[model samples]
Target: MDFQFLGGASEIGSLGLVVRDQGRTLLFDYGMTPTDPPSYPQPAPPTIDVAVLSHAHLDHSGMTPILSRLPKARLVATPVTLAVANLLTRDALKIARLEGYLAPFTTNDISSYGSRATAVDRHGTFRHRGIEIEFTPAGHIPGASMTLYRGAKDILFTGDLQTIPTHLVGGAESVECDVLVMESTYAGKEHPDRKETERRFRDKVAETIARGGKVIVPAFAVGRAQEVLMALASSGFETYLDGMARAVNSIYLSAPEYLRDSKRFRHALDGVHVIEHPSERKKALREGEVIVTTGGMLDGGPVLYYVGELYRDANSSILLTGYQVDGSNGRQLLDEGTMTIDDTTIRPMCEIGKFDFSAHAGHSDLVRFAESTRAETVVLMHGDRRELLRDALSGFADVILPANGPSFTIE
Candidate 1:
């Protein structure tokens, strides 16, 4: 058996890894990179026999629609992942529409992808030809899973996952294998206390509101948005959700039990407002409204319209509530202090703050996880820190970090 890291070795997204024995191949997590070298191509004949997914984050799962066009392919994911993946692909298409980027996969592609997928929700052994596969729950996203592939040689594929469990989900059981293809999203860092972060997040939202400013928060449309909404409600503020947020919340409802506070999920918007389109943003801007919008980076959403409307005002606040990946407008604004929205250099006059409510596990958690499992080799991916994983790990020298496009022999 041999393996290749098509992506997700040096970077945190576009996580693709391939494992092969003879002519048969198994790819794990077909993700798309936000920063485009315009890489990734349509697979040739024989193609990828089966692709396994861990979660629905775009960085980890976006390229599937493109790859699904290949022949004799089957996607294996959980029911919850299938539901969320469908939502993500559809949303990706919408985001692409505004950015002038073509979606690699069409609705039809997603449909076919969904059809070929065999949703499994169990802890058992499954066989494909002579290869043995097993999936365990990965506590990153609801229904997220890690797969173990056993053939002549044994290996595990860790999709983007959290080693330490959070309120929304829990981590996977680290199984023993020759190669552990794992994620290191928060490899070098430590996540802040959930209570502390939520308190601060709430306080910031309230402070901006109390100052009579529209607290513009840009969040992803999935888990983070719901998390922020719950935090706002706990903080006792009226949250005004805009863009695809309200739409996405319905999909979130598809897995209410997956949430830390299921009842709270439904009522987070009680005092809050929901803006479906750009026109409704005026009222939120003219008057001080705690507005939550999609396109988390102020890219291709009503947030940009609101920023254009109120960024000049120092009194306004922009609370960034998630990871701002590089090159994204959110990261540019959060890091550079200046941005060109609509070809205008809008120096960030508004107060900008970031709250790291990351769903991924941090440095200590990863160490704890590795130690608790007592796994011999821990493969790392989905992180920018190469040296961190190497230096921080204590007990293992076989922690493989495969560079993208590099292949490895397993048998």
Candidate 2:
């Protein structure tokens, strides 16, 4: 089998991989880095038999819509993944337009996706033209999956895995394979205890509220926002949700099977206020005790609006709940004590805080999960510090640290 990475082999964004075996060609994921102008993977090969999406995250499923143009390629993912991916891809197009960047795929391409897509359940198998692939939960978010391709050699591709369970989903399940392709996003890092972290987060919220100030939590719409909401469910704060996360919540609610606890999930949303339109922003600003909005990195979205109104208020706070990529506004705030909104840099007088609500498995967790796979060859991808994991796994397996645009063969 011949394997190659088009991108995201040495870094955490814009991930793609191609595998060719026994006259069949497969693409694992094709994604783009959602930065200022955005960065994309190499153009896909002219022909492909199947394209498997492990999750709906933009770094994994952003470019799958373009695959609809390929006459013979069939896109496969869990039903929840397909629905969420559709929502995200459309949102990406709108963002591209607002930012004055030409989107790679047309709206028509996204609409045609349903024709080319095959919705496989998390525990189901997909087979076409002698090609076989199986799905298992990845635990980063609800409906996220790790794919197993049963070819000449059983190869398992883990797309953004988390070994520890969160309020939204269970931990990733292990499967034995000959070759294991795993993500190393936290290759040299370990998260703080989840329960402890949540306690601190809620305590901070209460402190801000007790001080007669509103808390603005900027979170990623897909997984981070929902996780934060679940954490705040019992607090009885006047929480108001905003941005694309509202739409994402609806999709997750429709697919109850994808969530860890459907009843609890619904109960969590019941007590909170939903900002249905931009016209309600002022009402939320005046009434809400905690506002959880989208654009997790503080790069773009309704978060800017809330920050603009509350930045000068020393009593208010902006709490970030996701990874801040380099050059993002959130990183600037943490590093320089300032952020830019609409081309104007502003130093916020509001209190600033960050919590570890990350969904990726850390260094020790990665090593344990890799060992449990029992694979002879371990290929690590999707992190800047993958060497840390490579060294850790050296004695247990033939650890291969690959770079983008390179091909390696293993039999």
Candidate 3:
């Protein structure tokens, strides 16, 4: 079997890989690195039989439209993933146009991608040419999957795994394979206990509301936003869903089985007030309600508008609920005590707090997964801390850290 790391080998984004066995070629994922001007994977192989998508996150599915050019390339994903990917792709295009950056693909390409997509269920086995493929629940998001390929050799590709269950989805499905390709997003870090983190998050929201102050939670639209809303609702706090999160929340309701507790999730969605327009958002800010909005890293979106209004008010508070990438607005706020909006930098009087609501598995979880799988060879990707992950998995298997554009053959 020949395995090639196209992208997502040395960094946290642009995850892609190529596998060849028995004269058959399969592409795992073709995503783009999330930067000011996004970077895509090197050109795909001239011929691709199938392109398997693990999830709809931009970092994993951003460059999927590129597959449209391959006449024989058929996209394999879950129903929810295809639905969510379309929404996210359009959003990415809009952002690129607004920021004066050239988009990698056009809307027509996305349409072609959709027409060629083939939805598969979890654990269902399918064969294209000489390769057999199966997808299991990854527990990262609504339609995330851990892909398994059986060809010349058994290989497993874990796309952003999360061992710990969240309110939105259950934990990852543990599977055994000969060669394991895994993500190490939280290689060197340990997340706070889920129960304790939830308690603290709930308490902070309640306290801010009790003091007649609004609590703004900046979360990712897809997974983090839903999880935060569920947490807030379960804790007896009234939350207002704003920005693209409202649209995402509605989409979540369409696929009930993808969630942990469909009824509970729907209840939580019903409990929150959906802010549809700028006027409604402005009105929501005037009240002391807890608001959960998009732009998790606080780079843009309705969260910024909320920040602009509440930053000057000492009574309000902003709660960051995810990992803030370096040089992002969230990181700037956390590190330098200020947020830069167009041309001005604002030193907010309101309190700023960060909570580890990460969906990726932590260092301990990664170690446990590797030990349990017991693969002969393990390759780590989608993380900056490769050394930490290598050391942790050294005792379990032969750890291989391959860079982009290299093919390692298993003998």
Best-matching candidate per TM-score: 2
For each candidate in turn, the TM-score is 0.89, 0.99, 0.97
Q: Indicate whether candidate 2 or candidate 3 has the larger lDDT.
A: 2
- Candidate 1, residues 1-411: lDDT per residue as tens digits? 677777777787677777777678888887776443333422323588888877777777788876567887778877777778787778777667666787677888988888888777636456676767888877776677778787665667767667665555555666666666667777678888888887887777677777777788888776677667777775555567777767657765776655545666677767677776666677666654677777776666677777887887887799998888677788888778887777777796889999987877778877666655555666777777856876766456467666777676644
Which candidate number has the best lDDT?
Answer: 2
Point out the worst 10-residue segment of candidate 2 by lDDT. 113-122
Candidate 2 residue lDDT tens string, 1-411: 999998999998889999999999999988888898988999899899999999999999899889988888899999889998999999999999999999999899999976789999999999999999999999999899999999999999999999999999999989999999999999999999999999999999999999989999999999999999999998899999999988889989999998999898999999889998899999999999999998898888899999999999898899999999899999999999999988899999999999999999999999999999999999999999999999999998999989899799998
**Cα-based lDDT for every prediction:** 0.72, 0.93, 0.87
Q: How accurate is candidate 2 locally (lDDT)?
A: 0.93
Off by over 4 Å in 2: none
Which is the better candidate, 2 or 3, if ranked by TM-score? 2
Model 3 agreement with the true structure over 217-283: per-residue lDDT tens digits: 9999999999888887766666788888777777778888888899999888877788877788777
TM-score of 2: 0.99
| Best-to-worst ranking by TM-score | 2, 3, 1
Better of 1 and 3 by lDDT: 3
